[model samples]
Target: MPIFHKISLRPEVENYLKQSFMNEEVVSASSKQEAERRFEALLIHLAHPPSFTTVRVNTHLASVEHVRGLLLNELEKQFSGSSVPVLQHPALPDVLLIPVTGPRRNIEKQQCEVIVGAQCGNAVLRGAHVYVPGIVSASKFMKAGDVISVYSDIKGKCKKGAKEFDGTKVFLGNGVSELSRKDIFNGIPDLKGIGIRMTEPIYLSPSFDNVLPSYLFLQNLPSAVVAHVLNPQPGEKILDLCAAPGGKTTHIAALMQDQGEVIALDKILNKVEKLKQNASLLGLHSIRAFCFDATKAVKLDMIDGTEGTPPFLPESFDRILLDAPCSGMGQRPNMACTWTLKEVTSYQPLQRKLLNVAVQLLKPGGVLVYSTCTVTLAENEEQVAWALKTFPCLQLQPQEPQIGGEGMVGAGLSPEQLKQLQRFDPSVVPLQDMDTDCLGDAKREDMIWLANKDCIGFFIAKFLKCKSTEEKVSRK
Candidate 1:
């Protein structure tokens, strides 16, 4: 049975998604009912959190086992002495996976209500306590230290500072109010503090609210997989296009052992600065961030090879990772998406423009990875199909530790071609508590290793530009 109820999409967007699922190829292989079923599964799964939370340990500073022990101890402490097992990922050496326990169905709702914004609600589902800033409203007479039931206004219809919300809402769990209604709404106008301490949540993952800051990085399983797939060498020129807040950028720098030049680019200056700050926090200095539009990264005047920076000539980077901005339909615990059909389908052109620039900037025999967090066929499989036809020189290269499932069926891709592509399908495996002791030491490790494959809805397609073809032929 699915953990989440039906996810809400705008009527037009729902129609668009239905059409995509019921397209020629999909309808040919499966009945329209089957296609609609899968599409509905996609929607429901998107609103529920993944089963496990992955944390990438700073292996350059400490060993994976050492970090794993520290994290396990930390989890036990966080959960009030409940010994939650932290297992090592067998395939990837630098990763540690912790199984998130629950959809904890038995958590009872209370009368004192505290409402939070959608994003905040999503965080709580993924194991985060409600912060003051994310609070949309609280019950009247809700004072500090009062026990309050927390709910997420998933549809974004809740007016802030309201005593109660009758609109669409989902109960996250119960928590003790840290701030009174007056403190949250009227305290000095802009006061910020912890709003609620969550005692029970639907999906019980460890809330790493300042738990292990410098040592552990709480990242989604698929996002962690991306950095490893890029396989950053110690000294190389790498480009992370559309890198904002620099999660992958920092991971890439860490993987490089802080020895290489990692050029991080995002259109927004503030976002680029955030990339720099994340690098600084992680003690990684190999990254050189730039606030430049990726589509304009190539320059004809720079063919002299001396025009180095911002608008560099073609073949400038050794490896290019385009984690393109997409429709973001894959994000978990998202109860509602108010986007129109056109708005949801508008990212393909932008992604293609970014891909064109990324391909041009990659050196021959260099690897270029195109990834998106969304599960849209147009953004993912369709993009790969388009890339192969448009760029003949760009041959699909098999991923190094292909942890995710094969790409979805459709887009005229062959079985072998689809196998080379990685897609983290949310519905492939259902979330269930694992019997950790059922497997021996080696098998337990292997099961957790495969757990990396079960992740958020994501897609990664790697390509290598062959030298046999010219730029013109490649673009043909």
Candidate 2:
């Protein structure tokens, strides 16, 4: 019943991850075999998308029920009246969930193979239409209207425009080619738009492109949960470190009804621009996104802390979010990760730097939430351990809507502290728990009814700055 094959990492990468698991403070497996099995499960789950697509309705812009009705209509139309059951998340009043129909085993594969880059294929699994830029190569004689089997070039080794490929590829269902090989490579320097019209994707997820744009934002269920945990209020100042593409940034802005300051920062220029664009598309003007490395976001001088600008003095932000740059090992439908051990382990220092800056920039008694999309202990629970040890002023605060599994055991964090944390382990749960007919299965429904409980591989640790006057006086 597996929709995706168990993907294998390069041997060196595998060994490196094994050592990562076996690292002194990480998970203490009884044997190396146990570590390998857990890691292998991670890879298998990575090659498949999650069972549900989550959309956070902008309750500020539209009522949840109204948006839900619109979205359900749009989904039914998109899926050609398939009546794909759309459910409002029982706990998250502002969110809607659509089941991803998948591992669909009955579709016949066609002979004309269209090889696309791995990223594109992952998007396809999540219900995105195939764009031309991701197409590496199609059959030489392939033309528009030709039915073709779609495959993802998992290893990133496929040569573009090649007539044939013998390299490693995985079938990603089938579609009709919208462009000829000549049309894709012709005219402009870069390709654009719908290269293939997917008729039968093994996983049937509804695409959100241009659908209810302002009413809803497509976000990972966990990411949406993070915003609610932060629980921002109107007229509060919020800082989002490493906020790119503005998923949470815009959500925060919308949650506050556009009445507060939401400053978003990212290291890359293009990504920052994207954050701005998403904000604009959502009609959110409260977000001010900047392109800057967040580790250096704080300044010593009070005068440098001008409005709508960075280089702020200590305790300027009411709430801070460090959705730190991570190894991204948790992203699903990811067939391979080529990073070496050093590369995989490199984010620890960067995350610490960002966290240090975050604590400095947050107001006294303010909340700080640290999160990552990866499942590595170094990035998740261990980071929590490190943060608590390094900053005595910080204490782990219980997350609101504690929907995810408690923190993993190996980080030396106490039971109560681990209980306060949320880690969404995609590989730990089975996909069948989310099937349509299973909706009526009350026992099963009761188990996963909470919004925070079902989500991507994510980690969130909420911290409250201790209200010790001795610490405050010492700072001044």
Candidate 2 regions exceeding 4 Å error are 19-37, 304-306, 433-454, 467-476
Writing each residue's lDDT as its tens digit, candidate 2 over 114-162 gives 9999889989989988999999988988899999999999889999888
Indicate the worst ten consecutive residues by lDDT in candidate 1: 433-442
Best by lDDT: 2
Per-model C-alpha RMSD: 3.0, 2.6
Give each model a TM-score: 0.93, 0.93
| Overall local distance difference test of candidate 2 | 0.82
Alpha carbon lDDT of each predicted model: 0.81, 0.82
Candidate 1 to truth, TM: 0.93
lDDT of 2 at 407: 87
CA error at residue 79 for candidate 1, angstroms: 0.6
